[model samples]
Target chain A: MKNIFYITILIFIISSCKKDGAVTNPSSVDQTYTPTPYFIQYPFYWSYYPVPIPTNNPLTVEGIALGRKLFYDPILSQNNTMSCATCHNISFGFTDNGKQFSNGLHGEIGKRNAMPIFNLGWYEKYGEINHRFFWDGGVPDIESQVFGPITNPIEMNENLFNVVSKLKSNPEYPSLFKKAFGKDTITSQLLAFAIAQFERTIISYGSKYDKGILSNFANFTQEEKDGMSIYTDIYKGDCWHCHTISSHFFTDFGFHNNGIQQTFSDSGLARITRDPADMGKFKTPSLRNLVFTAPYMHDGRFKTLEEVVEFYNSQAYLGANKDPFITSDKHEAGLNLSDYEKKSLVTFLKTLSDSSFINNPQFSKQ
Target chain B: MIAIKKSWYILMGFCLVILLYSVSCKKDSTNATPAPNPTPSSQKYSLSINITHFFGDSLFKYNTKFINAANDTIKFNKLAYYFSNLKLTKDDGSVYAPETYFLINFDNSSTAIFQIDNIPQGTYNKFSFFVGVDSLHNHSLAQTGALDPGYGMFWSWNVGYIFNRLKGNFGAANTALTLDVGGDANLMKYDLPTSIVLTSNKVVNLKMDIKEYFQNPYAYSLKTDDSSIHDLSAPGISKLVQNSKDMFSVTSVQ
Candidate 1:
C-alpha cells in the first residue's frame, strides 16, 4: 500500500528527525520518505442506510483528541462552569452570541437558541429527520445528544455516573483515556464516542463563498453576483426546499415553519411528531457562519439579517403548517428587499465567513 | 582491475533490483480480505421481552383496572418503559429495520435487557417492533431515546408521543396508577395505531415474560405516591385510548 505509506512516512520522518536535532540516519531516514500514495478509505459521515461507525466506536485520532478535551472542558458541568463551549461558541461561528435565550447553570433560562456546531459529521441522521433534539426535536443519538446538556437541571447539571467519575480522575485523563480507549475506563459509551469524534471534525469547507465558487475567485460582483442568482432560486428561495445549499451542511437537515412562531406556545415539530402536520417545525439552520451564526430562528428571535429579511418579506402569516415554498408567490415568501437588496443580501452573507473557520489551530482547545 | 571489476558489477546490479522490488510488493500484499468472523459463538443465549401494564390503559385509562374506587389491587412501585420502532421480518417479505431502535430504559440500571448480539445464520419467521412514538417520531422535537424528556418518557407541558409508561406503588388504598400513556393535539391527529409482531431467528431464545403479563384476567396494576395514582403525567383521553389498549400484546415465540 504505497510501500506502507512510505514505511509510515519513514517512521514519521524518522520521528520528526529525532525530534528535530535533524537527520538521524536509517539510510538518511530512508531518503526523506516520499511515498504518499495509498487510498482505501471510507468512514467520514459513513452511511448506506442507518449505519455509521458502531463496530465498537471506530473513528479516532485519539478519539478526536479526547473529544476535543471533552468539548472544551467545563469538566462536563454541574457548575464546573458550562462547556460544549457554553452552548457552542468558537467566536460566534460555532454559534450562540445571538441569544434570545441562553443562561443555563443556576441563572437557568434556555428554551432554545444555540445551534452552530458546524457540519456535524456530514449529517445523515440527528434531528429534523422526524424531529428530536432541543428546540423540542427532543433527542436521540449524536451520542444521545450529549445526554441532554449533561442531565439538564436547566442544562449541564452533570451525572452520567458523575461524568464517568470526572473522566477517571484526570491526570492527563488516564493517558488520554488510554490513547482514546484501549482502556483507561471512562465510559458513557466512551464519552459519546469521543464527542462523536470531535463532532466529525466540524468541517465547514473553507468559505469566502466556498473559495469564490471553488476557484475563479474575485468574480462575484454584480451585487455579489445577483445575490448568487437570488440564492439559488428554487423559485425565489423555496430556500432550496429546507435551507439546502448543494453538498455537506448548508442544511436539508429538514424541519420548517419559517414563520417562526404564532399562537402555539412552543409545540415545535409538533412536540416531536404527534403531528398536527407538525405545527411550527424548526431545524433548518446552517447557512454556514451566516456572518457568524446569529439571533435567527428556534427562538434566537431575529436579532437581524435585516429582521430575517423582513420576516421573509412579509409572507407573514404562515400559520397551519405553511411551507409550500412559504406559500408560493414564486419564492417571494417576503423578498420586497430594496434597501439596496437588503445591503446586497447582507453582502452575500458576508461571503459565508470562514475566517479560517474561526481561527482553527486544528479546532483549538489546548 | 578493469575499473574495480566494473564497479562491483554495478553494485551487484543494484542489489538485484531491490530484490525484484521486494518480490513485487509481496504480490500486492496478497490482495487483502482476511480478518472476518473474529470468534464469538461459544453457544450461550437468552433473549426475552415481557412488559405489560394495562388498566384500561388509555381513553383516560380505559377499562380502569389498577382499581380502588373500592375494587382493590394496585401494587406497582416503578415499572420503567419505552419500546422503539424495530422490524426484523423475513418469511420472504424481507425487512431488517434499525434506522435507530432502543428499548429497556426502564429506570436504566444498564438497560435491564433488550440484548441483541451478532446473529447471522439464516432463518424463517417474523418480528416487528414499535410499541410507540411513530407519527413519524411523534410530533417531532426534543428527543434522545425512549423519546427523552429526560426519560420521564415525555409530556413536559404537552407535545405528544409518550405511548405507555407505567410507574409504581398502590397497596393499602393510597391510590397510585401513575400510568403515563401518550397522545394529544387530538390524539396526535387521531389515533388507532398499535403494533407488535414476533417469531424470530437463530434458534428459539425469545421469552417475553413480565410474569405472564400480570396474569391478566382483566388484570393491570399501578401505584406510587398515589393521589388516585395520578395517571403518570396527564396523557389525556384517559391516557390515550386507554394506554393504547392497555400496554402492547403478542406473547409466544417459544
Candidate 2:
C-alpha cells in the first residue's frame, strides 16, 4: 500500500511538472512529491470538541501556501487592480484599516464593512442555518462565499468564468494549483478550496485573553479584569451572550437584530431571509479583533468601541425585531452602564487583540 | 532490488482495486431487490417537464397585449421563475425523491424544458413540485447551474436565493420585478402536490397560467406604470407566495 502511494505521488509529480512546462524530460521530474499534512491545533480553551476538516478540502502545507498567494494576488480581480489583500490587509488583522465600507475596484465603495477573516473554522453553526461568511450570511461555507466579492458590481466585479479563464491562462497559477490540488487544472471549486483552506489556518489563539484564561500566564490589569467581568457576567455588561468567554472564537455565529437602528436603510438578515422580523439583523461579528476592525456594524455605522459601548449602554434601540437577549434585558432598557463600567468593558475588549496573529510571518503578504 | 519492487507493485495494484471497489459501493440511492430468476431487468424510463405560459385564456407572447382579472393591460417580454423539490410517487406508495432544481424563463428556449431521467419503468402518479427553491437548499450553500448566484437568482446582500424573477414590459411601460420570496421554511414553502399520472411513451407537460396569479385569492393587481419595488421586500412577498400556488397546473400527462 505504501509503495503504491509513493508510486502514485511520483506519477502525480512527473505528470504535473511536464504539464507545467517545468521539465521537458519525464525522467527529470520523476521525484515523488509528498506534502506535509497541516493539522489545525485547537486552542486549549476549545478542549471539548475537535476542529472539523472537510474531507474534500483537507489542509496541506502546499494548499495553504497556494491559498495565501491567491489571497494577496491581484490576478483574481477583473482589472488586476484589487486582491483580497487590497481590502483585508494583514496589519489590520485581515481587515480594511478602520474603513467603514471597503473601497473596491473603480473607486466604488461597498455596502457592508469588510469582516476580518480569522478562526472561520470555529464559526458556530446557527441551528440549521449556516451563516458561514459576510454580514448577511448570504453565502453558506467559505467555498461558496469566496465568489461574492469577485463578482459583486460595486466590489471586485470580476466574472467567475472569466476569473477561471484568467487563472488557467496564467503562467504560474497552473503549477501552483497542481502542487496544491494534485492536478494542473484550475476550477472554481479548487480555487475556493485553496482559499478556504488558508483561511481556516488564520487562528488567533495567542491573544492576551487566551493566555490569561487558559494558561494563567498573563495577568490582566484591574480595569481589564473589571471589563472582563462585565463582558462575561449576565447581570452586568451582558456581552457574553453573543461573544462567549469560554471560546477562542468570540462570536456565537448567530444572526442578531441588535438595536442599531429604528429605521434601517439596510434590511440586513431580513433582506436575505425576506422575513420582516429579521429586519436590521446582522451576524454577530467576532469580538476578537474589535481594536482593529472598526468602524463597527455591517454598515460601519459606529466609529469607535466607545461609541459601540455607549450605544449598548443607553441607546440600544427598542425595535420590534431586536434580539430577545437584548429585548429581555429589562425590556430593551439596555445595561445602562456607568462611565467606569463602560471604560472597563472597552479595556477588556482590547485584551482580545492578538498582535502575534497580525505579525505572523506565515500569514503576511510576501 | 528488482524482485522486491515487482512484488510491491503487485500488492499496490491489488490495494488500488480494493479502494476503487469500496468507493463504488457507497452511492446507491434506489435499492430495489433483484429478481430471483435470471432475467434482464425492466428498463428505466425518463421524464421531462415542459412549461408553457398563459395570460388568462390567451397564450403569452413577447410584447403581445394581455389583460388580467383587474382589466389592466400588460405585455411581458420575459416571465421567469425558480421551481424545485420534485417528488414522483408510484401507485404502490413508493416515492422517488430527486434533488432537481430549475430556473426557467418562459421566453427562452433552453429553460423551457427540464429533463429528468433514470427511473424504473412504471406508471407514476402524484408528481409534486415546489414553486421556489426548497428551504433546505436555500441557505445551505452557494450553488451553481440553476441556483447559481451567477444566474442572478441569488440575493447579493442576504443569504437566500431570489426564488422568482418577473421582468419585461406591461402595456407601453417596462415592468421589472425581482421577487425574492424567502423566509423561514414554513412561511416561504409554496408546495403544489400535483395529482397527475404518466405512462409509457408519455411526457408530463406543466402549464403556468400567469393570469391566474391576479385572480381570486391573489387579486394583487399590477400596472406597467407602477415602478419596480426596487427592493422586493415583504407585503409584496405575500403576493409572491400566493402567485406560486396559482401559477402552476399539470396541463397534460399524455
Best by lDDT: 2
RMSD (Cα, Å) for all candidates, in order, is 22.8, 9.9
DockQ of each: 0.01, 0.18
Each model's backbone clash number: 56, 1
Off by over 4 Å in 1: A1-61, A65-143, A146-177, A181-186, A191-193, A210-219, A223-225, A228-257, A260-266, A269-281, A289-317, A320-333, A336-366, B1-66, B70-254
Clashing pairs in 2: A138-B159
Give the per-residue lDDT of model 2 (tens digit) for A97-216: 888888878988878888998887756334225555677766667766777787787888887778878998989899989888787577776788888889888888777887887546
lDDT of 1 by residue, A3-121 (tens): 66457544544443343333344554645322122121322322232334435456667777788889899988886898888778887876666677778788889777787776664
